[model samples]
Target: MKKLLQIIIGLGFILTPFYTNAHVKWFTEVAPKKESIENILSPLFMGLALLAAVVLASLTIIIPKMAQMPLIKKWDDYLSGFRKYSRYLLKYGTAVALIIQVTNGTLFAPEFQLDSTLLTVLAWVTIGLLLVPHHIATKLGASILLILFIMVTVKHGIFYMLDYGFYVAIIGVLLVGSTKLENVGFPFLYLGTGLSLCWVAVEKWVYPTMSLDIVANHQVPTFGFEPAAFIVMAAFVEFVVGYLLVVGILNRVLGFVVTTIFILTTMLFGFTEIIGHFMIHIVLIIFIIEGVSFYNPPIKMHKTRVDQFIFIFLNFIFVLSTFVLIYYRFA
Candidate 1:
């Protein structure tokens, strides 16, 4: 009973709305009168819901165990069944940490005024978590993460969906790779992830500053500056980083720098461009994990048909979008 309650509490932490209250606050502050109530009460309701769940879970653990019921004994058995696999835990945990660090630092850190140095520290922290063995606590971590990610992506739309897709793919790869499938079709996975980043980079070139100032202004800013310079720089960064990422070169360094830039943009201007920074932060984390230096994955399987299909799809979207952004910016 106690174990089950603990798991329930852990899950609550993941799904609770208060976790993203900052975003809600920003939205409510900017929303018109009609939507103000949603902005105000949504997070509050969520917080209360989670609090209730936590309290209930605590009672389940404390009351039943003290009473020594058969139900509690049965619950403990079920809890014991969900044991953590240490090696798998380390590999996967490190992978997640890397992704989160990059997302927060590079893609979204700037919005928060965080330093790039903090990214490095976070990277290490994530890596350290992997070194430790998985406990029921780790399982709890994974479960909450999975649930929160699912909910956030669903609420956010295609951009969020794609973000979740990539994350899921990475998690699947890590979980599968930790087993005998270590030498399996890994390059394709990295390639897919890299292509996505590269595409975004290409768009950046045409909108150096990502027209971030306009985002800060909460409306598109007047485009009086020479957009050409920014566009060129963005393109160069995107192409170089994209190509290198796929080829497996200087991943950690690149990830650090990329995430740093993202953080800068968001902290500096993301409030006005809420969705932009939100999506960017999510991608930055994925990129960082893909770029981490600690683990050396041996190549076994080449790109399969499904992998090729995704590659083509992403390539088309990125290339088409890049040209469109460029044309629009110049026009």
Candidate 2:
């Protein structure tokens, strides 16, 4: 058990900078286009849109009510017993995500591949360390990841790298890896994800063109809205959900919904989406079951409503203006 703890700690380090690969729509690696709502709507599309809204509304009303049923509650209680395995999931999943990224030659983007064969090889080594399932090996993996992330950051600059969202996964790895801090790993992971979602949303805000390309290419079904509006609204949803995760609000429902969305996306986009969002899927799974922490995490995080609001506001500005300014100045 002690050795396992060490492995977990080491695994944490391996997750340092989880940049979305060049083709990944979830984390970054962007797309979408500018077909206006005014231009695209027809009677059939309008009917479909209304049907979608009705279905969404119905599900919103129904699923939670069903979740509270005795059988469902019993099942949830049963699942709670196995939540401990999420520890392994977090560690191994990170390794696999790294493997996918390395194999693809981009962080998560097949389009934005690394030029250096050496870095590619090093990424494989990181995967090997994650698979070791021991602290010492995991530590080695983390160390390697740290170096990789740092190198990437230096080249990309501190201001506006979409890869920065990887910090949450890093925190999860370290927290769960530590004997002293393992219990709080889930919360910190949630915080990291929240921050990541908001940060990625900024990418859409600044680079709407990238989002437009994605929406159009994916045939993501914008209902009657302009593709660009859909992209912006999608970013908002991403930001709010991340905020909710960070603030520990409606965590289970949000997690479950997000996980379902990712699953649907994987089906839509196939193997690349699977590779790109593997880590995200694991974290959401954890959130769906774990919901929040077993302990107070991040050392004095969110003790009150005011604290949550303050965090939400500050993070919003940080993700929005901070990145936008960097983009205008640097890129």
Candidate 3:
């Protein structure tokens, strides 16, 4: 047990820097460039990808066993105690994200700048509604957020706006609050946020040039790997994180590690990093609080150990390939 803990912690420390710097698009201006499918399917890429799949599959078996351990069970239960407050965290964290966006003259993301007075005022109004204590007020705020999202989609095109799809999930959570279906809100949040991260990770593979540019310009450390290879590893790390979130595996531990990584990156990326990732930070906190106690993840359906391992391994490969192909096709 002690050795296993040390290994996990060591891997986390090594991967932390890569995860922190993976949001290249947010920090750089390079346009997406299409790489040849052959280049993307290179031996090194496939090898690392297969290795990642095996590791994830192994974890699907290991994590459940780990959860039964006394210390881990206690920690999970302690975190679960805070689940009741998730709604408030989502509500005010969203309000804070809106305030940051409106004050900066942007919409949901830093790249989508507000271009008109009416839109700016509506953004503020949405923030005001979100701040109100009533459920109706929060729902109205979510409605306005949906409108703002649509407006930005109309201006920027759906492909560009898809990176911020988690906003729609946030809107869903707000609208469904205090209802019989409120239970579904957190699951949807996890799914939406997970898919968004996976989508962004695909961008790194599709447009390696952009990430390469960010690393070169920002002098991001590569830890002895060449910049291009480092980008590939980073993208894989991010994709695996998203996959874990979607599968509801290691919710609290994953949340704490990822949130810490994002916070550490602020030192390098500074204010822009915070503005771009504030909502994600909030979502991770909710993940820590919720900890998959109230929900049955897809992994729970497998019943047998071998079936569970196969399910995780195949699904990781399938999701990674599907995301890469779809993103590359659309790009």
Candidate 4:
């Protein structure tokens, strides 16, 4: 019962008020209805499902037990050592994110492309200030970020931009939070990134044909499942991992898993995956190093194996429920 309550500790629905008939109509108009669920879930999908089950079990069971082994303890200690450089790592990472936004011609989204040279120049200027050491620069950076946020929110609409706008908001949090709270920034970044991933995951569910098409063209291995089922399972994994990231539960282990997945994807897809996910690679490296920041620790972390298992399982359910509610309401 205590653990169930703990699941909701930091879980808050950030309602996007931009839910209107127009947006609903837009999504429904474009959503693909050709795929069948049973057709997608084949022998391969079951195999992948079994692997996912093992991973879930390992997180709650084997991982906690492995932590007691000497080899794993040394690894934990080594990772803990990187916490000292977390701030510097995050600051520079912000710069790379901004550069990627410009280079990609999109703020990480194809729809929200910044077309104007003037706005691009301004964004780069603010990005430059972020790298500078002057204390006043932080406030100036925050001002520019606020201006950009308003521009995006006004031009793109909150609902439209909410999918990837969180990245921009993360930059704002760092600049504003540095000058004031000195702490609010990273937590917001962590949350924003998680939400961004989950939001993108929903796209697969909404437009399964697009992903299935990609799968067909690429001949991507489905671990024995049909293309549609693999795509759906991929969405679930992305959403669940994103949820785990926000709640700060077994995040380091998940970080490794996601990183490995991305690397393997690069091997399979070749250069396109590399170019598309470059900034994400940077973010994953940061999470891999930092684990979860201690800045937003409301849930009392448990040490015992049983307590850890309950905590992880509940967080998974929390994210799963959130995803279902959001999908039904928005998608």
Please give the CA lDDT of all the candidate structures: 0.40, 0.59, 0.81, 0.58
| Candidate 3 local lDDT, 54-142, one digit each (tens) | 99889877877778889988998776666666788789879988888778877777777888998999999999999999999999999
Give candidate 4 misplaced runs (Cα > 4 Å). Answer: 1-62, 165-169, 176-180, 267-276, 293-315
Best by TM-score: 3
Descending-TM-score candidate ranking: 3, 4, 2, 1
For candidate 1, write residues 1-331 as lDDT tens digits: 5644554464334222211111212322332222122332344333533443343223323432443667644544443343333234234534444454355543222233224464355444544544445544333433434444454455455442442244444444444543566443245445555555554443332333423333344442225534433334344454444444454443433465665554544443333434323433434334443332333422113245344334433443444345445434432
Which candidate do you rate higher for lDDT, 2 or 3? 3
lDDT of 3 at 265: 61
Cα lDDT tens digits, model 4, 236-323, are: 7776666656655545666777766655555444433333455455566667766664545423477665665566565555555566
Regarding TM-score, does 1 or 2 come out ahead? 2
Better TM-score candidate (3, 4): 3
C-alpha-based local distance difference test score of model 1: 0.40
Off by over 4 Å in 3: 1-22
TM-score of each: 0.37, 0.69, 0.92, 0.72
Model 2, span 1-331: residue lDDT tens: 7645654574454333332222334533544443333443435433433443343334334555777889767767755765676767777877777777776667633444677887788888878887997877776777887777766767766654554555446634653575676665666677777777666655565566776766677676788998866765666556566655654553355566665554554444566665566677667766766755363533236555445445545554444445445544454
Query: Lowest summed lDDT over 10 consecutive residues: which window, candidate 4?
Result: 14-23
